[model samples]
Target: MGDLGRQLAYWDGAGAAKTFTHPVEHEWLAGVSRAARVLDYGCGYGRVMASLADHGFTELAGVDLAPALVARGRALRPDLAFDVLTDPPAVPRPDGSYDLVLLFAVLTCVPSAAAQRELIAETARLLAPGGLLYVSDLLLQEDERNRARYAAYADAHGTPYGVFETSDGAVCRHHSIDELRSLLGGFELVRERRVEVATMNGHGAQGVQLLVRAR
Candidate 1:
């Protein structure tokens, strides 16, 4: 199993249910028109997809790296579209297709900077002109425990400070705002705000949310 596959297995065994939502997500999603086609990348268990449906979005779909999560999402929201990616990452959508693409809490899971860049580039390719890309991820905070953990990873693997292991045996990346902005250079940043949200990994840490537009 790949890193994401292992993490997905952990989520499946641990009950992958998203119970929290950041206020920034609501604020950004409010801009999506009712007829807009939305794609929720890394959407686990269709929680956000269902929420979008409730918000009156007519066209909704999601893709996940975890089969169990995708199955759970399909079971939960049969009306919404769901697909599980193969070994290599693929979204299975036409280029410039969606009006909105969500990348909530996804980049943090990917350990490779190259993989993260490729994912972001693929997301950009999926968006139509003037489409929106919404991202929320763990921010590199000043917490002593997390800092110590990150340092240990750096010492052991010679990796960067942002990648660390969570209490639930899952690895995640905590990106600096500058790093995120540089990686998302293809998109035009329309709005960005730091929001404190619950941690997806078992380790509880503060997070940052970003909203951008495809250029």
Candidate 2:
């Protein structure tokens, strides 16, 4: 969460035009109670929250760092709750406030490993014991195009191997499976699946979705 000024500016400026394509597996959530309190971290414009509501899941709230994105979410989904996160990695709520936490395509936007760890820790703090954490995010790509970008950015900025900068002035990261497992060390894996997803720029990409329960 260090010096997120640039990322914040990018999202506040162009976030409204971006579309998140991470698929929410309703089947995975089938066992969850309809009344369970759910929190959608990095919920841009409430898209996933709306989908959850449509599938009969009630008591959902979303929080995002971008003001414009949160504003747009409130406008689009008036019934859902969306809050702007002025102090990130710290959602203002009591400990164990939520039964489920959604981390949809959020890690990519956070380029630093330390920041990602802090975010995950915050998510864990917000969840009740044995609560679920659903994560949908990009996996490192083997294709030449992605490889080249990864190398270029790593060489130029000295960021991690899978971290890269987009043409749209935003820095993002794709994670390895091992890295993700290390990040979620406190959680026990419940279910996992590999899926194809569209990037905000509409490019086809490989992604992993995980449903884990707090230990």
Candidate 3:
């Protein structure tokens, strides 16, 4: 968690790659523009959800686990609704209520695989049938066919980066594609694709994005 804080400081801090508006417009978002009740889970500084609102996604709400960042997000985009959860609840809304759920660059920050599953299950519970959930992040690829994860860039830049903790308990769980897959056991995967190449803290890797539908 400390490492992630430092990374956030590096990336979203003073002079970094881009705004908090990371490219969440992957293939998953492209397919579901009509969704009304959208929740930007793990929202930070509200750039992405603000952008979505700017694009006419009116029914939007942003939630994050960090209170300080959530306050900053509310300040940045006063028009949008913002909620802060020290530890995120199961679902932000009632079951089968949300038309869309977005966890952009959030899962990797999670402490563990069990937390990931809890997030996935909660999202599933909140999603209305045919509702869509969009997830994007830099994950350790199972197949070494491509050197496109943070670890590869970490190896190149000589900077160390990995999941050093899990949300449930214990310590150190390096995030991988398989772990994410295991987390999303109930969702039906619609598509998965690499969105961009991210180099953080002198380390670079491929960013993968996902679009899934509720079962």
Candidate 4:
């Protein structure tokens, strides 16, 4: 399976129709108007988008690289738009179109730092002048054994620090705060908070959530 396929497989184990909620994410969403155009980039099965809709967010759309996830999302919310991207790293949105672009848990799955930076640039391009970019990702937190495993992977393959393979054989990266800041330099920092929770994909780690505006 390709990266997208692997991601679909990973989420498949978690079930097709599942919804996730976060207190911090909900608090942030409280300020968003229902009329705002929102794009949930990397939206797996439209969980967050559904949550936004529940919070009365209209004009919401979602895009995912995994076709299966997109299909599932469509099945769950046929009234809402859900697109499957055939092209990797390409969002089929015009420049300065969206008021909010969410990148929750996306960067971690992208193992290459260069690709991550490029994706951020694309996201910036898609945002309106005052648009918001919300990001939540895995923070660099590893136990002793996990740290050694990450180190061994980096040493063996010369991968970047924090880049390692998950138990499912999928590659993911954990980011330090400084690294996150540098990668997100194209945007103006609004707010950032640390969330200590394991991901739904079965990986247990701390995460950092960021809210930024288009520069």
Query: Candidates sorted by TM-score, descending order?
Result: 2, 1, 4, 3
Choose the strongest candidate by lDDT: 2
lDDT of each: 0.79, 0.92, 0.63, 0.78
lDDT of 2 by residue, 72-184 (tens): 99999999999988888789999999999999999999988888888999999999998999999999999999999999999998999999988888899999999998899
Q: Ranking by lDDT, best first? A: 2, 1, 4, 3
Q: Roughly what TM-score does model 4 have, to 2 decimal places?
A: 0.88
The global Cα lDDT (0 to 1) of model 3 is 0.63
Q: In candidate 4, how many Å is residue 121 off?
A: 0.6
- List TM-scores for all candidates, in order: 0.89, 0.97, 0.72, 0.88
- Which model is ahead, 3 or 4, in terms of TM-score? 4
Clashing pairs in 3: 111-166, 111-167, 112-166, 112-167, 148-206, 164-172
User: How far is 91's C-alpha from truth in model 3 (Å)?
Assistant: 3.7
- List candidate 4 stretches off by more than 4 Å: 1-24, 201-203
Q: Between candidates 2 and 4, name the one with more favorable lDDT.
A: 2
Question: Which stretches of model 3 miss by more than 4 angstroms?
Answer: 1-21, 26-35, 141-162, 165-174, 197-202
Model 1 global lDDT (CA atoms, 0 to 1):
0.79
Predicted structure with the largest TM-score when compared to the true one: 2
Q: Give a tens-digit lDDT track for model 3, residues 99-144.
A: 9888877765654445566677788888899888888776653444
